[model samples]
Target: MVLLDVEGMKCGGCVRAVERTLQDQPGVQEASVNLVTRSAWLRLDPAALDPQQALEGALEALRSRGFSAQPRQSGVLSANAEPDRAWGWWNQWRQLMVALVLLLLSVLGHLAEAGTLSLPLIGTLPFHAGLATVALFGPGRSILRSGWAAAISGVPSMDTLVSLGVGSAYIASVVALVWPAVGWPCFFNEPVMLLGFVLLGRFLEERARRRTGRALKELAALQPSSARLVMADGSVRDVPVEMLRPGERIELLAGDRIPVDGVIEEGYSAVDLSSLTGEPLPVDAGPGTELSSGCLNLEATLVMEVRRVGRETALARIISLVEQAQARRAPIQGLADRVAGRFCYGVVSLALFTFLFWWLIGSSLWPQVLEVPVVLMDHGHGHGVHQSLGAAAQTPFGLGLQLAIAVLVVACPCALGLATPTVITVSSGLAARQGWLFRGGDVIERSAEIERVVFDKTGTLTLGRPLVEAVLMSDDPSRTIQLAASLEQTSRHPLAHALLQEAQRLNLPLLPVQDSRTVPGAGMEGTLADAPDPLRVGSLEWLRSQGVEWPAHQRDAVEAAQTGGQSLVAVSLGHRPIGLVAIDDRLRPDAVTALQRLRSQGLSLGMLSGDRRQAVERVGQTLGIQTDEMAWQLLPDQKLERLECWRQSQPVAMVGDGINDAPALAAADLGIAVGTGTQIAQDTADLVLMGDRLEALPEALGLARRTMRKIRQNLIWAFGYNLIALPVAAGVLLPGFGILLSPPLAALLMALSSVSVVVNALSLRLP
Candidate 1:
C-alpha cells in the first residue's frame, strides 16, 4: 500500500472522481480518496510486482484526469511533476478586486440614472455592458473554465453552476444592449455582482479549508532535519537525518530532540515524550531503553544506536496513520458523497426545466393567470420610451429568459459540497489538539452510534500496577517477603513489582538465588545460597503441589481479600507455607466518574479481564457493572469473540491498553486506546486518548455526536433550499401572485447560502 497526496479535491464529488480514476486503472486493487486531507491511500495487486511501474501508471492516470498527485514519501516517482495547477490566490485576489470595482461602478451608475444622484460614466448601457464583459472574462474566467471542464466531463461542480448563471446573465444583458427589438430588461450589474460575491466566497472558503489539515501538517513538521552522528573514533558530525542508517551511533545532548528510533547504549535522561504521546509527563530512560523519534531529551547527554529511520520510525508511522484516518470516509459522509456525486446534474436539469416552463407553458396567460405589468425595471440603464414605468414590462420571451437566468443563479451546490467535509476536518483538528485522535470520520460516525462500551480492566480501568494491600498470618512477615523478593528478583510481572517495591521501600536484604526456574502459569522456584530446600513463591494451588500447609487463622482474611479481588502470592520454604502477600490493583482515580457519565447517556457498559472470576466480579460490582455484562479469565481471542457476538446487535467500542487486548480492539466496532498503554494497543485502536484521563473519553464521544449532527443539518438545508428555490426562480408563483425572482437577487441568495454552510461548519469548535 502507498499513500499519495492529491490536490484540487474540494468535496465528496471530487473524492468519487479521484477514486474512480485510480480504481479503473489496471494493476490497481483499490483506491480510497479522502476529501478532507486531499490524500489517497492505494492498495495494489502483488501479482503485478513492480512498485515503481504501478506508481507511475497511477500518477499518469490521475494527471490525465485533470488531477495533481504525488507519493508522500520522498524519492518516489511522480509521473508529472507539474500537474495542472489552478490560478494562484494572487490571481484570484486580482480578479475579485476587478469584479468588486466593476460592481461598484454599475451600482453608482444605476443610482445616478434612477434620478436619485449624479455620477458620470457610471450607469449607461455602453459603460455597464463594457464593465459586465470585463467581469465575465476576467475575474470570473477560472469559474467559467472549471464549470465548462466539469460539464464536459459529465460531472458539474459548484463552479459549473456559478459559471452558467453568470454567463447567462451577461449574455442576456449584451443582447438587450445590441438589439432594442429584443426588449429585455438589461440589468448589466447582475453578472458583475454575481462574480464579485462568488469570488469573495471562494477566497474565504479556501482559507478555512486549508486549516482542516493543520494537525497533519504540524505532525509532519515535528521530524528533525539533522542528527549528531557519532563516528567510530569518537568524533561527531551533524548530518542530515535521512543519511543515518540502522545500527549507526548518534549523540543526544540535554534539551535536544531524538532524531530517530534507537536503543540507548550509554547514559540516562528524563525524556519529554509529550509531543509524541500527548501525555505531559516526562519519562525516565536509561541504558538499554528504546526511544522513538520526536522525543525531547532533558538534562542528560546520551549515546544511542539507531534502530529505525525515515518511514519506519514510530513518529512517521503515527503521522501516516493520522493522515489516513483523516481521509477515511465516515458512514454519514458516504451518504453525503452519494448526493454530491449527482448534485450538479440535478441542478442543471432543474434550471433548464424552469426555463422551458416559463417560456413555453406560462407565456399565454394574462394579468389574472400571470401579471405582465406596465412597469419597467429601468434595467439598471435607462429604459426605451415604449417601455412602461409600472411592473412587468417585458415581452413573453424576454420575461421567460429573465426567469431562466434567475433559476440558474439562485441554485448553489457549494453548500452541499462544503457541508460534511468542512465539519469533519475542523472537528478532527480539534480532537488532535485535545490529545485525542479520531482516526477517521468513520470512527466519529460509529462513535455517534455507540450503544455499548467495553473496557479492559488492567491499565484501561485500573492503573495495571498492583500495590501491597495487606500482609498477614506469619510471625516474621518481613523475612518471608525478603525471601520471596529474592525469587522474584528478575521477573517483570505486575505482582513481582508490587513485592519488590515494598521490599525496596523498607530496604530489605535480598538473598542470592541459584538455579532459579519459572514454573509457567504456577510461579517461580529457586534455591537460596545457604538454604538446603527450594524456595517457592507462586499461586496457592502451586504451593499445595509442594504439600505446604496454610495457617487456619489466616483463611478468613484470605477469603475476604480474595472476595474483594486482591491477588495472592504464596511463599513456601522447605515444603511448609510461609506468610502470604495480598496484592491488588487500584482503580484509576477518574474511572468511576467516567463510567457514570457514560451510563448517564443510557449506554450499556461492560468490563473484560484475564483475572480470576472473583477479582473480576469484585471490580465490576465496585464500578456498577452487572455480572452478566462482565467477562472474566478470558484469553485474547475470547475477548475478540465476545465483542464480535455483542456487535451483532449494536455497535460496540472496545477500550484497552495491553498487547493481549490488541485483537479485541481491532475486532470491535470501534477501538479506543489509552495513550499510556502499549504501542500495539495504540496501533490497533481507531481512537486514541493520549492523556492519562479517562474523563476525556466522554468528551470525545460528545464531539463526534455533535459534528455528525451538524453534517446532517447542513445536508437538509442544502437540499431543501434548492428544492424550494428552483421552482420560485422558474416563476411557479407568477400565475397566482405575479412574483418573479430577479437575477441579481438570486445571485445574492446563492452567495449567502455558501456562507451559511461555512459558518455552520466552523461552529463545531469544541465547547
Candidate 2:
C-alpha cells in the first residue's frame, strides 16, 4: 500500500476523479481517496509493477487532472523537514482577507446608493464593477481555474458551481453596464458578495475539517525524531532515531518519549503509557521490561536495546492502521458516493432548468417579482434608479439569471462526500487511543453488528500462565520432576513453562533425554539416556494410547484433580505409571467484568477450549457461561467448526490469543486478537486489543455502534439539506410567499451544510 498527498481536491467529485485516475493505472488493485485527509491510499500488485514506477505513474496521472501529488514520507518525523505548505492556513487566510476587502467595498457602494452614506467614487457603478472584477480574478482565481479544469476533464466539482454562479453574475452586470439600451439591471455587488461568502465559508469549513483529525495528529506528535545511542565504550551520542538498528542500546532521559520498541537493558523508571494505551497511571519499568515506542519515561534514566524501529514500531503501526481505517470507505457510504459522483452535473442541469422556468413561465405568472425594486444603480452625481427592476422586467432575462445563480451556488456535494469518512476517521483514532486497533471501516461496521462473542479458554479469558499446583509421584518426586523438565525445556507450551518454573524453584537438575518430540493437543515424549524405556509426559488419554497403564488407586486422585479445574499431566516410563502433575491457570483479572459488560449489551457469550471438560466447566461457571455455551476437549479444527456453528445463527466475534485460535479467529465474522498473542493470531484477526485489556472489548464495541449512528445522522442531514435547500434556492417558495434565496445567502448555506457534517463527526471526539 502507498499513501499520496493529493492537492486541489475540493469535494466528492474530486475524490472520484482521483480514485478513477489511479485505478486506471496498471497493477493498481484499488484506490481510496479521502477529502478530509486530502490523501489517497493505493493497493498495488507487487508482481505486476515496480514500486517506484507505480508512484511516478500515479503522480503523473494526478498532475494531468490539475492536481499536485507527492509520496508521503513513512520515516520517523523529522524536525528539520519543512511542514506541508500546499494548503497552509496562512494561504487560506490571505485569500479570505482579499475577498473580505472586496465585499466591504461593494457593500459601501450599495450604502452610498441608498443615500445612507456618501463616498467619493465608491457609489459609482464602474467602481463597483472593478471591485467585483478584482475579487473574481484575485481571491476567486483558484476557484475559477480549478472549476474550468474539472469541467475540461469531464468531472466538475463544487468549485464548478461556485465559479459559474459568480462568473454569470459578473458577466450579466458587465453586459448591463455596456449596453443600457437592453433595459437590463447592473448589480456588480452580487458577484463580489457571492465570492466573499464562498471564501469565508470554506475557511471556516477547513478549520473544522482539520479538527476532525486531531487524534491522528496527536499520535504522530508522540514519535520522537531523535534518540541517544550508547556506543560500545559506554558513551552516549545523540543521533536520528532512524539511524538506530536492532541490538543497539539507546539511553532515555527522564520525561523523554521512548524512541523505539525494545526491552529495558539497564536502570529503572516509571513510564507514562497514557499516550499510547489511554491508561491513567504510569507503569513501572525495570530491567527486562518490554517498552513500546511513543511512551514517556517519567522518572529516572534507562537504557533500552532497540528491538524494532521506523515503521515496525508499535506507534508507527497504530498510526498506519488509523490512516488505513480512515481511508477505507464504509459499506453504507456506497449510496452517498454514487449520489455525489454525479451531483454537480445534476445541479448544473437543475440551474439551467431553473433559469428556463423563471424566464419562460414563472416571470409571466408573477410579473410583480420584477417590480419589487431590487435593482440598485448610480448615475454620475450619486443619483440611483429605483425604477430599474420595473424596467428590467421587460427583459426578464436578468431576473431569471439571478435566480439561476442561486440554484448553482446553493447545491453542495461536499457534505455527502465527507459524511461517512470523517466519522470513520474520528472513531478509528478514538479507538486507537483506547488500545483497540480497528483494521478498517468494514471491521467497525461488522463489529457493531456482533450478536455473540466466543472466547478461547486459555490466554484469552485466563491469564494463560499456569503454575505447578501439585505433584504426585510413585517414586521420588524430585527425580520425576527432573526427568519431565528435561523433555519440556525444549517446548514453549504454557505447561512447559510451569514445569520449568517449578524445577527452578526446587533447584532440581534435569536429566538429559534423546529424540524428544511433541504431539499437538496431546503431549511430549523422549527416551532417557540412562534408561532402556522411553519417558512420557502428557494428557492421560495420550499415555493410555501409548499403552501406559494408570494405577487403580491413582484414578480417584486424578478424577478429583480434573473435577477441581486442575489439568493433570500423566507421567510414565515405558508402560510404567510414574506420577501426575496438576497445573492450574487463573482467570484474567478483567475477564468477569468484561464478559458481564458484553452480555449486558445483548450479546450471547461462549467459550471454546481444548482443555478437559471438567476444567472448562469450572471456568464457565465462574464466568456465568451456561453449559451449552461452553465446549471443551476440542482440537484447533474443532474450535473452528464450533465457531462456524455459532456464526450460522448470528454474527459472532471470536476472541483468542494463541496459535491454535488463529483458524477460528480468521473464520469468525469479526476476529479480535489479544495484543499479547502470537504474531500469527494478531495477523489473522480483524481487531487487536493492543493493551491486552479484556475490559476494552465492550468499549470498542460501544464506540463502533456510536460511530455508525453518527454516520447515519450525517447522511440524513446531508441528503435532507440538499433536498430542501435546492428547491428553495430555485425559487420554489417565490410564487407562494415571495421568498427567494439570493446567491450570497445560498453560498453561506452550502458551506454550512458541509461544516455541519464535519462538526457532527468531530463530536465523536467528545466524551
Candidate 3:
C-alpha cells in the first residue's frame, strides 16, 4: 500500500477524480481517496509493475491533473507533524478579512443607493466595480484558478460551480459598466458577497474537520521523541528513539512518555495508560512487567529493555490501523460516491436549464416578478438605481442570469462525499483509544449486524492459567506427573502449563523426551529416551483412539473429576492406561458480567470448547447460556462447523484467544481476538481487543452500532439537503410564494450543508 498526501481536493467530485487518476495507472489494483484526511491510499500489484516506478507515475498523473501530490511520511509519530501548505491558516484568515472588507463596502453601496445613507462616492458604479475586481483577483483567485484547471482536466468540483457563479456575475456587471446601452444591470455587490461567504464557510469547516481528527492527533502525540539510553557501563545518554534497537536498555523518569515497547528490567513505577486503553487510573508496574510504547511513567524512575522500536511499536501499529480503517469505504458510501462522481456535471446542466427556463418562458409568464423589489432599495419612489429588479429586468436576461448563479452556487457535492469517511475516521480513532481495533469500515458494518456471540472456553472466558488439582489411577503419582511434564514442557496449552507447574512444585526431574508431537485441540505425545514403549499424554478421547483403554474401576475417578468441573487428561504407555491428571481453570473476573451485558443487548450467547461436556455445561450454566447453545468435546474443525450452523440462522461473532480458535474465528461473520491470544489468532481476527478485557466486547459492539447510526444520519442529511435546496435555489418556490434564494444566501446554505455533515460526525466524539 502506498500513502500520499493530496492537496486541492474541494469536494466529492475531486475525490472521485483523484481515485480515478491513481487507479488508471499501470499495476494499481485499487485506489481510495479520503476528502476529510486529504490523503490517498493505493493498492498495487507487485507482479505487474515495480512499486517505486508505479508510485512515481501515480504522482506524475495527479500533478498533471492539477493536484498537489507528495509521498506521505512514514511512521505514526510523523502524523502529528503539520504539512507545509503554501496558503496556511494565517494566509487564509487574511484573505477572509480582505473579503470581509470588500463585502462591507458593497453592503454600504447598497444602503446608500436605498437613500438610507448619503455617500455619493461609495455608491458610484466605478467604485463598487473596483472593490469587486480586487475581491475577484485577490481573495477568490485560487478558487477561480483551481476551478478552471479542474474543468480543463474534465473533473470539475465544487470550486468550479463557485467560480462560474462569481465570474459570470462579475463579467456581466463589468459589461454593463463599460456600455450602459447594452441594457444590462450593474450590480457589483454580488461577487463580493459570494466570495466572502465562501471564505467564511471554508474557515469554519476546516476548524470542524480538525476537531473530528483530534483522537488520531492525540494518539500520535503520546510517543516521546527521544529516550535515555543506558550504556553498558551504567552511564545514560539521551538518544533519538528511532536509533534504539532490540535488547538496548533505556531509562525512564517520572512524567516521561515511554518511547519504545519494552520490559522493565529494574525499579518500579505507576504508568498511565489512558492514551492507549482509556483506563482512568495509572497501573502499577514492577520488574518484568511488559510496557508498550506511548504509555507515561508517572511515579518513579525505571529501566527498561527495549523489545520493539520504530514502526514495530504498538503505537505505530494502532495509527496505521486507524489510517487504513479511515481509508476503507463502507458499502453505503458507494451509493454516495456514485452520485457525487457525476454531481458536478448534473448541477451545471441544471443551472443552464434554469437560465434558459427563466430567460425564454418564465420572464413572460411571470412579468409581475419583474415589478417585485429585488432589494431593499425598491419602493414606491423610483430611485433609478439598477439594483432593483425593475431596472435589472430592462431585459429578461438579467433575472434569468441571477437565478442561474444561485442554482450553480447552492448545489453542494462535498456534503455527499464527506458523509461516510468522516464518521468512519472519527469512530476509528475513538475505538483505538478505547483499546479496540476494528479492521475497517466493512468490519464495523458487519459487527453492527451481529446477532449472536460465541466464546471459546479456555483463555477466553477462563483465565487460561490452569493448575493441577489431582493425579489419579497411578501407583506412583510422582512418576505419572514427571512423565506428563516431560512431554508437555515445550507446549503452550493451558493444561501443559498446569502440568509443568505441578512438576516444579514437586521438584521432580523430567526424563528427556524425543520425537515429540502436538495434536491441536487434543494433547501432546512423545518417546522417553530409555522407555521400551512411547509415552502418550492427552485427553482420554484422544488416548482411546490411540488403542489405550480406560479401566472399569477408574470410571468412578473420571466421573468425580468431570462432576467437579475439572478437565481430565489420560497418560498411556504401550496402549496400557497409566493415570489421569485433573486440571482446573478458573473463570475470568469479568466473564460473568460481560456475558450478561451481551445478553441484555438482545444478542444470544454460546460456548464452544474441547473440554468434557460436564465441564462445558458447568460454565454455560454459570454464564446463563442455554444447554442447546453449549457444544463440547469438539475439535477445531468441528467448532468451525458449529459456527457455520449458527450463522445459518443469524450473524455470528466468534471470540477466542488461542491458535486452535483461529479457524472458527475466521469462519464467523465477525472475528474478535483477545489481545493475549497467539499472533496467528490476532492476525486472522477482524477486531482485536488490545487490553484483553472481556468487558470491552459489549463496548465494541455498541460502538459499532453507534457509528453505523451516525453514518446513516449523515447520508440522510446529505441526500435530503441537496434534494430540497437545489430546486429552491432554481426558483421552484418563486412562482408559488415569490421566494427566490439569492446567490449569497445560496452560498451560505451550501457551506453550512457540508459543515453540518462534519459536525454530526464529530458528535460521535462526545459522551
What TM-score quantifies how close candidate 2 is to the native fold?
0.86
Q: Is candidate 2 or candidate 3 better by lDDT?
A: 3
TM-score, candidate 1, is 0.86
Q: What tens digits encode model 3's per-residue C-alpha lDDT throughout 271-328? A: 9877776666788999999999989999999999999998888887777777777777
What would the TM-scores of all predictions be?
0.86, 0.86, 0.86
Please, what is the whole-model Cα lDDT of each candidate in the order they appear? 0.76, 0.83, 0.84
Per model, state how many residue pairs clash: 5, 0, 0
Q: What's every prediction's RMSD, in angstroms?
A: 4.3, 5.5, 5.9
lDDT per residue as tens, model 1, 1-767: 77888866655566677888888877788777766557787878868757678888999988776677888762111224323223465676787788888878867766766767776766567777788788888888877987787677765677777788888777776676678686676766778877887777667766666666666566656677899999999999999998999999999999898989999999989998777666567888999998888888998999999998987786676666566566666666666667777777776777777667656766765534333442221233234421111136355666666666667777776666667767777777677656677767778888899999999998889887898776766678888789888899999887888899989987998889999999989999999999889899998888888888776876786666556667889898877777788888888888999999999887899898988887788789889999889999998888888888899999999998836687888888889988543355336888888657888888889888898899898888877887887787777776666565666666667777766776787788636
